[model samples]
Target: MAKHLIVGGAGFIGGNLARELVGRGSKPRIFTRASSSLVNLVDILGSLDIVYGDFLDDVALRRAVKGIDTVFHLISTTFPGTQMESSVYDIFSNLLPTIRLVEICLASGVKKIVYASSGGTIYGEPKTIPITEEHPLRPKSAYGQSKLTIENYLNFYARSTELDINVLRISNPFGFGQKLLGTQGIIAVAMGCAYYNRVLKIYGQGETVRDYLYISDVVDALIRASERSGSSIVNISSGFGHSVMEVVEAVEKISGKMIQKEFVPARHGDVKVNILSNKLAKEIYDWTTKVDFQEGLRMTWEYLINKRT
Candidate 1:
């Protein structure tokens, strides 16, 4: 059994991964910011070895990686929409620290590290309907560029130092425990707005496409990536594509509330379509998404409703 260290164990995917680890009897160590909310982690706090620190702290990062066999790189300080406005902040705060962390992981003698990359933005626009891992990387957003940069560095380290690094280019993931107030997460945010009867803004015609995977499916992919012997990048996603308008309709149908909408100009760097093919993930990890779109939306809506009330 590998000694686990999760870099951002308090966020949506990170928290779910940590919970799954604890359920399997692995006492994982987690590094999180002191200001990060503990709402998602409350159930499993007793089982985790918590380290409160920022990634920019070199000493804290070194301490977090010490004696750990595998590292899960899941923290992100910037999202695609807002990253361009703060490019320098993204580079100094996110990119530089990640480079340093990789160096530390190598020095710490870590066995392998799994990087949670973004399939949603990394490919920019899709040339084919369901994008495979072989698709050309033309990330339009600063956030996607940063992720690709880290991925390239990981490849370099893996080849040069024989460090094992795996990348999961995951699509948009949504389910319970997701933060609704964030700039991203259309599903969760829509549900929250409907619950309180707030106006939900739609960009362009609201026809931009995305492949939405459930959170548990993503957690499974993370675990499988950690267990694999060889290093590889795979798309962890639902093979189906849905439009933003479709998501709005789904939320309204499930919640029995009309989601007020205002059309806004589409944001720059927003991709026209992003649908990932899970063929590689299935062939490698024998993984498939078990949750249907409507069912997953219903589950997420109920959780958001209950939490709101």
Candidate 2:
């Protein structure tokens, strides 16, 4: 059995990935910040070895990577309203931690590294629909640019130092355990608001289309990427997109509840439409998204309902 390390494993996607690894009989060590919430990892606490560490601390990061066969780097930070305008948080906060992790991995003799990149922001306004890995990198937000920068650095390190690195540009993943206040998942937040009888605010006519993937599918792709041996960048998405209105409609249909919606001005740095092509992921890791939009919405709604009850 291989020993795997999940940085930021207390987060939404990282928690799911840790559970999946435990199910597969792999010993997964989760490194999370001391101040981070443990709600996502509460159920699996007994099964996982939890390390309280931060990526910015080089000593802690190296300690976490030591003796690990593979690493899943998923640590990132973004201010709620200032994700697009600021480069300081993206550079000093995100990029610095990533660079340190890369250095630690190189020195520690880790076999492979699976990095989580942003599929939503990296493509910017999208020059092509169902964006593939070959699309030109035109990141509009500082968040996207920072992720791309780390990705390019990974490529350079792979070429120069013979390190095995794989990047998974994940789309919007929604499901249980997702932080309702997080900006990434509109579906999760809408479902929560609808369940609690709050207004479902739709930014910009609810026409912004996104490739919504289930969290389970995202975990599946991450695990598969870690198991496979190769240095490649692949898009982890459903390869299909749904508008904000479409998602609300699906939620309404599933929960049999009417939702009050308010259409607000278009958010700054918002992409009108973005979808990622998973053909390359399919060919590379033999992975494809299995959950449809409607079904995924139902599952998420049920989870939230169960949590409330």
Candidate 3:
């Protein structure tokens, strides 16, 4: 088994990745902040080596990367909807720390890095349906721009150094362990509202479309990316698009309860529609999403209902 270190191991995706690693008989080290919540990793506390610190700490980053064969970079300080208000902060905090991380990985002799990127926002509004890996990157939000910046840096290091990098431009992932209160993760937020009998908020006429994938499928893609050799970028998505209103209907259908909703004016960084083609992911990792949208909705609703009661 290969040893691994996760940069944002306490987060939704990172926590799931850590659990998956433990299930595979790999003991993984997770670097998280003191203020970060560990609710997502509560059950598997004994299975992981946890380190507490911020990603900007050079010494902690160096220590965490030592002796690790691969590093899973999943830290993101901003979201597409709110990044525009504090663009400079996103650049200084997220982009700079990631550059430093790449430098540390290069110096510490880490073999490879698997990056979790944004497929939902990276391509902006698609000029064509089913966006491919070769789609032009015209990101609208600062968060998307920052992710693109890191990708460019990874490409640079791959060309100049001996490091191998894999960028998985993952689509919208929602399932168990996601925060229900946050602005991100639409499905989780909808489930929260439905459970509490609150109004589910939808922006811009509820017509914005997104490609959703489950958390377990994303972890599988990450593991595949870690095992696969060579430097490349691929899209890990469902290749099926669902509108915002459609998601609400799915939740209503699954729970057998009506979901009360409200439509507000669209935000600045919001896109009209975004979907990714998994052709490259299939060719590279022989991977395709196993969970359909309806099944994923049922699973998420059940998890949310169980958690609430």
Looking at model 3, residue 132 earns an lDDT score of: 98
Candidate 3 lDDT by residue in tens digits, 1-309:
688999999999999999999988878999999999998788889999988888889988988988888999999888878657688888788889999999898888889999999998888878888999988999988888888988998899888988999999999999988988888988888888877788888998889999999998999999999999899999999999999988888887788878788889888887888899999999999998889888888888888877768
lDDT of 2 by residue, 196-301 (tens): 7788878889998999999999999988988888688999999898998988888888888888888889877778889999999999999998898878888888
Q: Against the unseen true structure, what C-alpha lDDT does each candidate score?
A: 0.90, 0.85, 0.89
After superposition, the stretches of candidate 3 with alpha carbons farther than 4 Å from their true spots are none
lDDT of 2: 0.85
Candidate 2 wrongly placed segments (more than 4 Å)? 79-82
Q: Tell me model 1's lDDT, rounded to 2 decimals.
A: 0.90
In lDDT terms, which candidate is top?
A: 1
- Lowest summed lDDT window (length 10), candidate 2: 77-86
